[model samples]
Target chain A: MTPRSVLVAILAGRPNAGKTSLLMHLTGSPQRPINFAGTSVERVESRVVVEGTELQVVDLPGIGSLSALTRDEQEAIGFLQNRAAQGSERTVLCVVLDAVKLSVELRLLAQLSGLGLPLLVALTKNDVARASGRPVDATELERCLGVPVLEVNALTGAGVAALRQAILRRAETGRPMPLDIDPAAVAARVQPGSAAPARSLTDRIDAVLLHPLLGLPAVGLVLLAVFQLLFTGADPLIKLIEAGQAALAAWTVQQVPAGALQSLLVDGLIKGLGAILAFVPQIVLLMTLVTVLEASGYMARAAFVLDRALSSVGLSGRSFVSLVSSFACAVPGILSTRIIDNERDRLATIAVAPLMSCSARLPVYVLLIGAFFPPRYAALVLLLLYGLGIALAALVAGVLRRTLLRGGHSALLMELPEYQRPSRRVVVGQVWTALREFLVRAGTVIFAASLVVWLLSYYPRPAHIHAHYEARRAEVVAADPTAQKAALLELDRQEQAAYLEQSYLARAGKALQPVFAPAGFDWRITVGILAAFPARELIIPTLGILYSVGEVAADSYELGSLAQPGASGEGLRARLRSAVDAQGRPVFSTLTALALMVFFALCSQCMGTLATIGRETRSLRWPIFTFTYMTALAWVCAVLVFQIGSALGLGPART
Target chain B: MSHQETTLDCLPPGAVASVVRVEGEDQIARRLGDLGFWAGTLVEVVRRAPLGDPTQYGLRGYRLALRRVEARRVVVRPGQVP
Candidate 1:
């Protein structure tokens, strides 16, 4: 196939204008970042094939105007103006305007009309506008603006095909129509019969949502519902996936000949990928909830609700959205901070964003809590961990703002967009996009990390140990079938434990164990924590490997089974429970688990989040600062928790 | 003489005012201008946040919340005597 030449079609609009939805609908591609060839600036682009011509649909950050002050807005303008300077041929501007807020939207449109690029107006939210008794006449708008104004409802795919064709046509032969209008004068002309009401339905909704007495509690209830829906909706699917993965891993091990390939497929690839993909359901649900909240305009109201409290911590209400998103994962959370206009405020938000206990930390938390705490207290413990994350984030933000990024007090001068029912298509598309991202990362980074981990745990050439297990397995084969199977399992477990103890990873963990002693960590726990540096979720599988608990799926792995006595008359947990140092003191305790939880909650362990911080800030300094400070904070906090708990004799020796 | 000008932060809830001037020539002021808080634009303090530091203002056919510090930058004149 001949490579199609790419034409750049820039999609620009005000915040909440459905620009991203249009881009997704037009291209039918999940949102992917396109590094502009040879430029430092990168924007999300989808390769769109339109009428036998390939068009690169670049979705620029939403900006209010060309004179925008935020870095994101400036980048949007720079992308457009650079093309405009190069003579605007191969470039077309698709300006999406929210039909209900045409006056404000048109003001931005007016500024961009001077850019001298062929512009097509996508007047979105037609359904909402009509339902609210305010509809923009596309013909009238077209005639007034001297451009093809397409009335598009992104939700229903109305005018979407026509809009795509329009883009192609504009790219082919259209010229810049330099038409400008005084927004204030034209604002009154667009509304035909009824005057623009100062108190719209949004105000009434905000009355309740932003109310002093009910707003906070309403927000709390909404948050509870969001998480409840996420957990309940995703639990069954997670269980199903975990079971399938385990069964597949066992089947693959049995079917494949005993070789490195089988070990790689079963131990490294399957286990690693399964560990990562298992979180997809929860992540999808989270993206869906966030999309619904955002599209319905509740997110802005949430910012309004949180403005005062955030201000006390030197953050504006704008940081609320970013912080909330960080709970799911920090990459998108940092990306979402583009909405905050103030530079210092945005940086401060990004710096503390990873402390929000992202979903990557969820597996570790669940596994540890399930193992150490009772089932009845699971929900409360999880809530407390999440709450601790948020509290620490706020405290860190305050300190960072006061020291590193200090400046004028933050202002909450942001628009409260009119409430509209979230589009089902948009929410589905967002979830799909999030799931694709998760799978891609699992297929790449986690896959590689898992392979390395599997290799390290399988090495050091313990030939004698393998021979010994084989002899024992032959002897056990003479016994009954059940005894033979149990004997083989025990031999496998001993072989793995013996190999791991002599591996390079074990040596490194032992070397670092003393440093983590104050934090109540043993060599194995230190190894788990070290392995998690690439991604927080890796700690669970790492622990499974370190303890000879092979191929354990995080969601379904029974702690009781791991702790159950085997042929050696002791399980992994039993070994952990009885482990001691040179001084004959127990290595693991309840206090240690709590300290580890606190450490995971505070540490910047995920490489993706750190890389995202670097990309978003366009500097390595911030990411370095973020990693160093967060790690230091985690160490100190974990040490303090352990020391205090040990001093008070808070936890029993072994329950 | 200046029509008893007061900062937007001081305007009690439900009081309408027309912006007389934006205080600074900084980016914050320019952004406020971009958001339609320029001179002669009518604004009202619709409500205050729970802790009362940031106040929601109804202006230019939409509702926006501005902190007291940001609101202080906008000089306004009371629109009507109640």
Candidate 2:
């Protein structure tokens, strides 16, 4: 069929008007989010074939009116205007309206009707409206607006089929009619009672959730629960994924010959894949909770509850959602900033989001804490690292608002949608979308990065280094046959360490070592830090390789001293603990570890996050600014921590 | 009966009022108008946020949260609670 036979049905509505839910029902497919040209505003489009005619349903960013207020709203208006100009015969605008809030929503409907596009009304939440004694009569609405109106319950799938059929039919055969009815007048004439019940279910729920005395604490508890689940609840799943990856890597080693290809496949590709997969559990958990919160309409209340506190930092309540999402992963968090209407607030939120200590940083913190601090203090240090991230994020956001993003008064005008059961399909769809985007990044950017790192560490294998190790192995074999296997293993480790000492990565790390000397990091630690730029979790494995400990699972660093013999990651901790510099000075001290943790906590190391920031802001400038500022701040903090701790006799020399 | 006029921010929780007009030509004022805060629209102060800065208002069958700064721009005539 020609492309012209395909019909495009644009679902337009205000926020929380159930347009997304309705679109999901209509298409019977997961929505694909696409960025509009030259804008970061994402719109979801899904296609369904009905009766041999293709129908494309596009869910626009929700807006209050054609007179746009926010960037996304302007995007929606621009899109509609473009469609109108392009000749709207093949396009039908399906206006989704909340049956309970028809008066205000109808203002949008009225505005769209004036566009003279083929129109249809999908009145949602009829059940709630009817139960509240304010049911919208679809027949009366259809008569009044001179358009076919269908009442749809997206949750139960009631009336959805009829609505889909109506949309398709309207797109094919309907023509725009001049409608002269004022939305306010029509709403007043149809639904006369200007008063709603003093306490609806949502109101009652909000009464408790938004209680002046209890709301803040309630929000705190909710956030605590989310974080608890994200870190602890997903621990076992993360461990399971790590174990699976380790097993797969071991199996690959057994199947492949010992060569560069084997190392690349196991250490580079599989390890990178494992790093990507390791974050899935936490991201999935976080996104599921976030989607549920958003869908149930409690997110707005949480924003409201925190607005006053956040406003002190030049952020509105809306920034809280993005920041919280960043706690899981900054990629999704940056993407979610579209919901914030104010451009200045959105940019400020995006600027500080990466500082929220995402799950990727957990491995680095665990490795450093396990290596440096005592077991009892591990928890405290971890908490301090997380706190450092948050405190810095707040400070950075406040500073950004006062400087780069200053002077725009962000007025918080948000709709508190009626609380409903989070739609199962919608939640799953959202989680899937987040997972898909993350996996795509891992496959492309992470994969390429891992390959580049592998090449750097693997190449220039000088024959003399291998010959030296082979001679040592031969001498050990001749000297003692019984311990030949163990002796060869030692020689192999020495040979790998020797080879890496002169490799390009190590040379670069050494070149940059002086820059990081104030932070107490040696060449090896500098190399690990440099390698982790693409993904923060790579630091552990890179450190494992740098110390000649071989490939270690990113999560296994946590099992430090308690690890069983032959555990892959246990060797790295012991090596790092006893490792010394050229002058026989200890390479890593408690102060060094603290400085390193602080550096990791603040540095904008993740290329994925930077790319996402660039994409979201639609500019290279913001991402560059984010990188420069974060890196500079990290260096300053790391140096300060190192210098201050050293002066206070908190170094390895004192301990 | 005398008609009393005041900004929406001055209204107490549960006070019902009809909007007179959004007083400014700024984006926030136009946004308020877009959200059905135009003239003659009945709005109720549903509740205040926990910190009491942005307040929730019931208008046109939906609850909207507006900070005091934005609310201060909407002139309203207080009416008797039904």
Top TM-score prediction, candidate number: 2
The DockQ score of candidate 1 comes to: 0.54
Q: After superposition, how far is residue A246 of candidate 1 from its true place, in Å?
A: 1.6
Sorted into a CAPRI-style docking class, model 2 comes out as medium
Off by more than 4 A, model 1: A1-8, A24-57, A125-148, A157-180, A192-197, A374-380, A438-443, A467-484, A549-575, A578-585, A651-655, B80-82
lDDT, model 2, position A19: 83
* Clash totals for all candidate models: 0, 0
- Model 1 per-residue lDDT tens digits across residues B10-61: 8899888888889998878877877777566778788887777678887665
Which lDDT value does model 1 have at A311? 75
DockQ of each: 0.54, 0.66
Error of 1 at B2 (Å): 7.7
Superposed Cα deviation of residue A496, candidate 1 (Å): 0.8
Least well predicted 10-residue stretch by lDDT in candidate 1 chain A: A560-569
Candidate 2 stretches with Cα past 4 Å from truth are A1-4, A33-42, A194-198, A441-443, A553-555, A559-569
State the displacement of the C-alpha of residue A41, model 1, in Å, after optimal TM-score superposition: 4.7
Error of 1 at A68 (Å): 3.0
